[model samples]
Target: MSDVFEKVMDLAKRRGFIWPTSECYGAVAGFIDYGPLGAMMKRRVENIWRDFYVIQEGCYEIECPTIAQEAVFIASGHVKGFSDKMCQCPHCKEFLRADHVAEAGGIKNPSTMKNEELAAAIASCTCAACEEVLGTVEVFNFNLMFQTTIGPGSQRVGYLRPETAQGMFVDFSRLLRFYRDKLPFGAVQIGKAYRNEISPRQGMIRLREFTQAEAEIFVHPDEKNHHPSFKRYADYTMPLLTYVQQEKCEEAVPMSMQEAVDKGVIANEYLAYYVALTHHLLVTIGIKPGRLRFRQHLPDERAHYATDCWDAEIRSERFGWVETVGLADRTDYDLKAHAQQSGTPMTVFIQYDEPKKVARRRIIPNMSVLGKQYRNKAKAIFEALANATPTAEGADVEADGEKIHIPADLFEVRDEIVDIRGEDIVPHVIEPSYGIDRMCYAVLEQSYDEDTADGEARTVMRFPPNVAPIQVAVFPLMTRDELDTIAHEIARSLHKAGILAEYDDSGAIGRRYRRQDEIGTPFAITVDYDTKDDQTVTIRDRDSMKQVRIAIDKLPSTVCALLDGSLKFTSLES
Candidate 1:
């Protein structure tokens, strides 16, 4: 591991952020335990995300099971699909993802090749892991999803879901009913998705099981061409790495969201609009705005069914531009697939204002003349013309590229007027899928920093106040009788005000402040001796360490304001 990764691991472990799973005996490769502080931070982050995608956007949130049935996967095309080309080491008997190995080794499309082709590619390349001459790497398709049996006897085969998108697709009909059968509404799901990693060694970056926050927005096919809410993010700047830019420019280009949509880089207004919103939300969640960019997937890398796709890539200290979120225009693929498989209609009844009238074409074959000429085949010709609509060949169209010659005993062909009602349509889907675990790590990496002052360096997590694990750290300066009692009382008061206040009296005031700072607690409230007479406590800022004296009665509003960002520590410092 690199020095920075080691530091991150050490800091995370020491500060109750993250740890390996089942360390009592042996640790699991693809599992992690979120410590007390880490759990709070993660929960707060997810809640804030909900505030944006669910509450603000008027979308409903859904929870689904981790293990899905084989039918669900088959319908979603995950059974035959959802695979990565993998090669196993002969000596160590370890499996490896072909794409990762080829990319790190500076090769291209290693997974797309056949077994023989991949075997040839590997002969020229060496394994970074063992440095042992890597054997012939036969490219075998390996499903990333972890398989499990739903019932007791392993009779029913199920697999842990690879993505949360399928859940939203499966529940489309119910969601449509719940939303009063409206188009252009979204269903969001935030939960765990699993992947069985092969030879995992990227720390928390690549995990077998991770959390995902996914949104499936269904809209009419024509509606996707333009979004009414596009103006909301029109002026926002998004650093874009398009296919053309990647090929031509040395770095990503920063432009308004509207410009990208108009220039055809984003494909449409709806895709661009959400890309900008995602950009704004990421910055709000403590991901550094500079290290973030929306990278468009190339034609070869894009999903076969996607109309357009982009990834929110966060530059990690170690991994260099890792994909944290995916925004794709699925365009009625999932629903269509399910409809075909289940033989059930998954459509909303869109009511039109008025019925339409139009001139129609009808083919009426002349059966009177055919009855005298060829009476045997007269019925067949009449049936064929009645069932046939207008084609290039007019009446009695060709079957299998060959004309079925019939006698003229059928009805005649003519145009007739007809009145038409509304038609049913398959709503296209625009999905914004997020890898929540990766975003959590990005927030940590971006907010992490070291400050040096007074001949010593202090490490602090400069997390946003709302998402910080501990909102306040209550401390007694001397751990004295009066100070300690008042401090505990003050902690209780903060807790009642809905703040995550932690009481620390075992160490010096500075040490207590340091501990709080490590976990990204925004404020430190100190109840000193003067509180006994004047009823005042000192409120210290985490970032600046500036202290302010406030009355006990006013402490709640002051701290609450600080937490809500309505009031700032700098404003109250003086």
Candidate 2:
């Protein structure tokens, strides 16, 4: 781990941000427990995501069970394709991801290699644990889904979902109805997803169970080039690393969403809009803009469902650029796959501006001849034939588990003109999936800073005012009755104003300030003797360490404005 990562993680554990799960016993890898402050910050991140996706973009949010029937994933293609290359160490008998091991052993693009190629590449790799030479290790595919039986019997199969997206896709018909059968709509799911990792080495970055906040926007396939709110981020500029740039080994360049769409770097307006929105969300949640970039997925790197995808990667000191969010254009793949597998029609009816007369050949079954020849089976044959498309010579219809060819004499084709009002089409999905745990870790790492305060080294987490776990900390100048009472009152006022405030009277005022700073509290309110004489208190900014005294009555609004970025601390009168 890098020095910054270690420092941030140490601060996180000591200050109640996050720690290993089941630590009293031997803790397992790939799992963690969020501490109090960590939970609050995570929820705040989720709420901010909801504000952007649900409230601002007008997308409906839904929650589904983490465990789903096997068929759901079978339709989504997770059963056959959601896997990673795995190889077991000969001496240690420990399993590890083959591609990761190959990459660690100086192989380039190991993930795209074939199984044979990967085995050959990782032949010289050593075990990460025992350091035993892995000579000619056998590499095979390992499914990542956590499989289990749903009922008492093992006959019924189920698995924990690897993503929240499949649930949204499975509920497409209901969501389509919820949106009044509209062509353009979205549904968001924020919950836990599980992936059985071969070996999770990264602390919080690669967890077996993690939170995902995903939004699946369904739009007409032909309308992908146009989004109703595309203008919201059309001119928003951000760093983008296209596939061509990656091939050429070039750095990411600043480009507007509009320019990316026009240059075909981004697939469409809908995808570009969401990519820009993801950028805004990451920055809003304390991710440094300078350390964030949107990188397009190379052809071989995209998922089976995604036609075009971009990953929002945050540069961490430990992990160079970790992907926290995926913006993908999954063109009608999910809904279509589910519909075909489940025999359900997942389509949206789009009405035409005007009804038009269309000409087509209609198949009419000859019931009289079919009744004489087959009797009871004749009716089934007629129904099947009526729905079947007729060829030049005949029509093929399945009835009674038998394929019967109806010759031109048995079925009649008529050219008819019919008035068509609308058509049903499977809507394409543009998904923005977020790894919440990774985002939280990134926020902690990026916000970490060390500097001198009052001639002493101070470690602080400079979280954004809105994203901070505690918006303000109320501290008493001293452990005095009057000061404590005033501090409690101020904390209560801030709480009633819907602001998170922590009250501290355990130690000296400086110690309390440092405590809050370690946890990324944006502002600290000190109720001193001046507050007793005049109904005013001093508020210190966490970043600038600047103090401003204002009337106690104006405290709530002042803090609210400051937290909301409507008021600047530097502009405040001291």
Candidate 3:
């Protein structure tokens, strides 16, 4: 870990934000426990995401079981493809990611290499930790899912979900019904997803189990370019690093959503819209705009099922550009896969704006002749023949799970004019997947700051008021009963008004202010001698360290305004 990482983690642990999980037993890597403050901050982050995806985007959220049947992954292709290439070092007897090892040895784009290719690239490399020459490193696939049995004796195989997206895909038929068979509808899931990482050493960046907030917007395949809310982000400009630019190692250039879509840089408006929204969300949560970029995933790096993918990456001092969100255009892959595997119709009936008369081929089955000829199997054969759409030569009919070829005489095809009102289509999905833990880590890393105040070095977390763990801190100027009573009362009043306030009387007023500042408390209320003369207290701003005295009666409203950005701290003092 870097010095900045250590400093931020030290402050995080000391101030009750986060700590390693199960430290009492010498905790293992990649797991963390959010302390009280960290929990509060996490809730704020999740709620903000909900407001954006669920409320503003009008996507209905759903909670699903984390443990799904093996069939779910089998259809989603996770069973066969969700794996990381691994190799074991002969000298150190340690396992490592083959691509990561190859990349560390200065091999470019090692992740795109085949297993045999990756093995050859890293064969001459040495173990990073043991410094021993790695010999005969055979690369193999290591699945990242946590496998388990749903019932006794491993009768029903189950695994923890790798992403929240599959749940939405699996529930497509139900969600379609809920939306009344609408073509452009979305479902979101925010819950725990598990990946049994091979080696998780990057603090909160990689985890065996983490939270994912994923939204799957199912739209008609032909309508991806036509989002009803596209106007909201059409003019929003952000730095976009296209896949072509990435191949040449070029920087991201600023481009508006409309231009990106028109120039075919982005696949569609739906994908570009979510990309912009993710950028806005990251900035709102305190990530510096200059340190953030939307990097388009190269074909070799993107999932095979995804047509286009972009990662919202934040530049961290320790870990470079860390990806926090993924916006992908998964073109009907999920629904079609599940539909084929499960034999469930995962399609939406899209109603056309106007009913149109169209030329069509109609098949008429000869049931009476088939019944007499087929005997006992006649009904099944007739039913199959009736449902079959005939070609010029013949038609394929299915009966009792078996396909049978029916002759031209069994079914007759005729051209007819029919009124077609709608069509059934497997909707394409636009997913904006978030790594909640990584996001929290980024927020903390970016918010961590240090400066000199009153000739003393002080560490401060410059978290935004809306997401900060504590909005206000109440303190008594001195350990006097009169001032303590006033401070406690003021804290109670603030709490009643739905403000998170902390009361401190153990240290000097400056120490109290510093303590609150370190935890990102936006405002601090201190009760002093003047409180006895008149009901008033001093409010100190965490960022500016400026003080303003306001009446006790006006404290709640004034502080509420400050927290919400409706009333500025500077304006209050002036």
* TM-score per model over all chains: 0.85, 0.88, 0.87
lDDT of 3 by residue, 1-574 (tens): 4578888988999988888899999987878899999999999999999989888888989999999999999999998788888888887778888888887888899878889988988888878868776767899989999989997787899999999889999988889989887778889999999998877988889998899999999988888999998989999999999999988998889999999999999999999999989988888888889999999999999997898999999998989999999999999998899999999998777778998899976677777877777677777877776667777678888888877787898767778999899888888999999999889998899889999998999989999987899989999888775888888989999999999999989866788888888999989998889888988888999999989989999999998998877998888866
Instruction: Evaluate model 3: give its lDDT.
Output: 0.89
List model 1 lDDT by residue over 1-574, tens digit each: 4556677778888888888988898999988899988888889889988999988898889998888898888999887668877777665666777666677767787656776777677765666666666767677788877888877887899999988888988888899889998788999999998988766777788888889999999998888867878888888887788977776755788889889888888988888888988998888888878889899988788886697999999998888999988999999999999888878778876766787787976766665776666576556655566677645444454444446655333445567777667677899988898888788888888778789746779888889888789998888877776789888888898889888889989877778888888878888888777777798889988888789998988888888999888998887765
lDDT tens per residue, model 2, 1-574 = 4599898998899889898899999789999999999999999999999999999999989999999999999999999789878999988899888988987889999988899999988888888878887997889989999999977767899999999999999998889988888879999999999999877978999999999999999999999999998999999999899999999999899999999999998999999999999999998988879999899999999988899999999999888999999999999899989999999999988889998899987777777887898898898898888788878888888999999888888878898999899999989999999999999999999899989988999888999887788899998898785898999999999999999988989877788888888888999999999898999999999988889899999999999999988998999953
The candidate with the higher lDDT, 2 or 3, is: 2
Between candidates 1 and 2, the one scoring higher on TM-score is: 2
Where model 1 places Cα greater than 4 Å from the true spot, the runs are 84-141, 359-418
Ten contiguous residues with the weakest lDDT in model 2: 361-370
- Model 3: CA > 4 A from native: 84-141, 359-366, 376-416
The candidate 1 region of ten consecutive residues with least summed lDDT is: 392-401
Candidate ordering by TM-score (highest first): 2, 3, 1
